[model samples]
Target chain A: MFNLFLKTMYDKRIFIIAWSIGLAFFAYLMLLFFPAFKDSGLDQLLATLPPELKALKGMIGDISALSTPSGYLAGQFFDIRMPMFISVFSVILAVGLSVKDEEEGYIRTLLALPLSRIKLLFGKLIAIVVICVATTIATVSGLYLGALSVNVNLDWTVVSNLSLVMLLLSICMTTLVYCIGLSTGKRGITMGLGILVGAGSFLLTTFAKSVDWLQPYEKVSLFHYFPAVDIVKNGISIWDVVVLVGITILSILLTIILFRRRDVR
Target chain B: MTIQPVLEVDAVTKYYGSFLAIQDIHFMISKGEVVGLVGLNGAGKTTIINLIMGFLRTSAGKIRLFGEPVLPENAHKMHPKVGFATGDMSLFTNLTGRQYFAFLKRAYKLKDDKKLGELCKQFNPDMDKKIKTLSRGNKQKIALISAFMSGPELVILDEPSSGLDPFMQQKFLELINHEGAKGTTIFMSSHYLKEVADVCSRVLFIRDGKLVKDVSRAELESSHGKAVHITTSRAIRPPAQSSLLGHQKTANGYEMSFIFKDSPIKLQQWLCSISYMLDFTIEDHDLESAFSDLYSKDKSEAKNV
Candidate 1:
């Protein structure tokens, strides 16, 4: 299991490094523009907007808090941007590890080794978690350094809490994709369903605020548990963490069970 | 003391959805035996190999390796004692051959690289080049080396000589012979009849998801009988004999050929009964002719059914 883990990590080293650098740079760029938005009288502009346009604010956060450091960062980055980017990354990673490998017959080489299917999958899961944690740290570091450069007094604890939630959310997305990939062993299905779930969850949660019919079902969407604006203002919520962690664990168990029952290529 | 077979496939059946890939396939290989599985494409050779390797589970029945049942959960425990290589086996494309070997070495928990070095020297693969950059034959060399490097007790190969040149194929056969001499029971699937005849002590013929025949080399040679060619003086009706197989007439009904499985005395009596017989010759039957005869008979049987 350790050997498989080490090999997976080594194989994905370049991928992890590239995502970390890219996400960090993106976060830095977003922070660089935060000061401009704060000084541009955007609050008054947002307040004067029509109600129909105002309803779209659910996708980001409270329009009134757009001028504050925590709210601006949450609304612009953590709320939608970070989750979208991480989800995309998670889908690709999961598909590559499962469906792509099987389709290309590379999984046969690994299976021929003296390791059980469960160990092989667990090794890959650990590697995915490590990559997600590394990228999250890079994003947080970029945010902290960007804030320092702009002389913004930011609370590091709340930011870390938000980062933790982001990490869990990304892991949840990855495990879901991994489960689908291993279950179907089809690249198209895995990617399509992975993107749908990630994007669908975010859309459902966002529209739930304005669309009364979607409110009760909002909890079904993974993004509903990830209230980025609330996390930035009020620190982490244990219930949200529990929900994400529960989904991740369930996805992992389902992945193992399905993968074990199927025929490998 | 009775010795246990190295591999035992007991009435194993596999189905892909509703399609029966292999049904009630049964075979066994003892130690120091080199067995070959011969079949046409989609003949369930690979399916049986996958089942034996525990990459696919048996729908009905069981497969055991080294006296333990081969289940996906416990298959890995037997993997250290088994080496598997397939023609289409994919390697880590980004890694050099050397790196791939290093990973395998770690996975197998080998004490030293001695066996790997020996295999590299024998196969002469370019260890410094990435696998993706290598040719098909070169990649196959890497696979063969990896399978043999661990010095497994039982090696299973599926079309192991697919991309190999004749020279490399000869080298591979020599390796199989050498390993077999060391009491390593080897089971391989191949389309190359000559290769099977050269190295395998026993050959199993699979056709349409069933084990059609299993014969040892000595039994195959003795039981297949002789190829007979006879020239007649006139266009007379050919003698009706149940032992005659694949009978064909040419040269305006003067020349006739068939496989004679009956005794030599019976052949002589039948030949003597034909007064217009001009000339005749009988020779030992070859495996190629035997294989074709078996498949052709099967095709006719299927058509009849």
Candidate 2:
């Protein structure tokens, strides 16, 4: 089963590597080249966007003290880039491992095996988590390496801190999408819904702030606890850690329950 | 000969909404026997297999596998004990034949890679190309390998010879016979009676969701081939048919080949009186005739009924 997960994860390595490279380039161009834009809130760029788009990319984390290489790298990677990477990773892993198997007729072969449904789902979830962690660590390290060429002070504390925070948020989103993927028997539906859930949460959170009446809806949005911007500015909060763990438990439990109850197509 | 029944289906009836697919289907297969479920398309052969596999719910009746009821939760686990290859089952397109074979081998918990390789080499299915690239016959060979890879006690194949060339079909027959010789019970369903006759020890005839015949190989061999044709050496004496049976004249003479349900000897004596000397003999019955006879009966009886 571990081998099965590894085999599937190996197939998606290209996607992860490509994404990490793209994230590194974005981080380098925005942080190193255009330094002033870090604080410059282009109101047109931020405000003209629809409410959903704004809500999706919650308040940007303050990277003010991010003068050093590691701080700037961590601020960019973990603040905005890591969440996107994690969400994409989570959604793809969840959908690929769950729905794609059925859509491609591999599930027939997989189910023909002498394993239980829960076991297959459990192994896939573990594989998704492992991929998420490996990709996150690589993307963060790559961002830092990109900063290395620019000659800035290194700070492992900030990088590790940011990684940990992003890891928590990423796992939560992955588990949630993983469950949704299991519920959706087809690949297209799973992929579509997974993207919506991940990106939609972010937009919902941003919209919640602007519309006072919709603020309560923000509490349920995963971006509410993601704290990408907040974590960089204020460090990790105790409540965020607690809420993240709670999210993991809730999502995993839902995944297991859905797997057990849902019919395997 | 005393032998254990390898598979038993008892009073099983399944319904898809108001559409009744199968009704009270009951049958059993002895150990090492090659059993064929003979049915036309839409006669509910697949439905029966689905119920046996616990893929669909049975509204009534029960199916016992090796004397144990197949519980819903444990049905998937039964794969190791039973190898099933369906004609319409979708093959994984991305995996190469080798990869797919290896996957099934591991899934079935066959530790000996050498054995798996040897078994595959016997059929010589292509390993380099993905399933999507393979021809229909080659793809079927791959499917057969996966189905037989587990070396289970029972193998249920639906339309097993479908899409195979004559050579492959013969190979398929040999493969199934090999499994049977090794004490594997094969319960295959096919619309082609000749194919089933090649390997099946018993033929179970199904029509309109009912089992009409459970004839053994010996019985089928003896009866399925007997065809009766009566010809006369002399002209008929009276009204087309006195009352014995419908009569028709041929180039030879007046002839009547009413359904011959009696021994050739008895019918010979009876026909001798009708003509000075009659040229009459029983022609072997082929599947086409048996099928036509049965179907014609069904149609006629249905109209009368």
Q: Total clashing residue pairs per candidate?
A: 0, 11
Question: What digit string (tens of lDDT, one per residue) describes model 1 on residues B257-282?
Answer: 66666777887888889987878888
Assess each model's interface with DockQ, reporting 2 decimals per model.
0.77, 0.30
Shift in Å, residue B89, candidate 1: 1.2
Note the Cα lDDT for every prediction shown.
0.84, 0.69
The interface root-mean-square deviation of each model, in the order shown, is 1.1, 2.9
What is candidate 1's lDDT per residue for A121-225, written digit by digit as tens? Answer: 888888888888999999988887889888887777778878889999988889889878987788899999998888888788789877878889989888877
Q: For model 2, what is the error of residue B263's alpha carbon versus the real structure, in angstroms, after optimal superposition?
A: 7.8
- Interface RMSD of candidate 2, in Å, is 2.9
Alpha-carbon runs more than 4 Å astray in model 1: A45-53, B223-226, B229-243, B246-257, B260-273, B276-285, B297-305
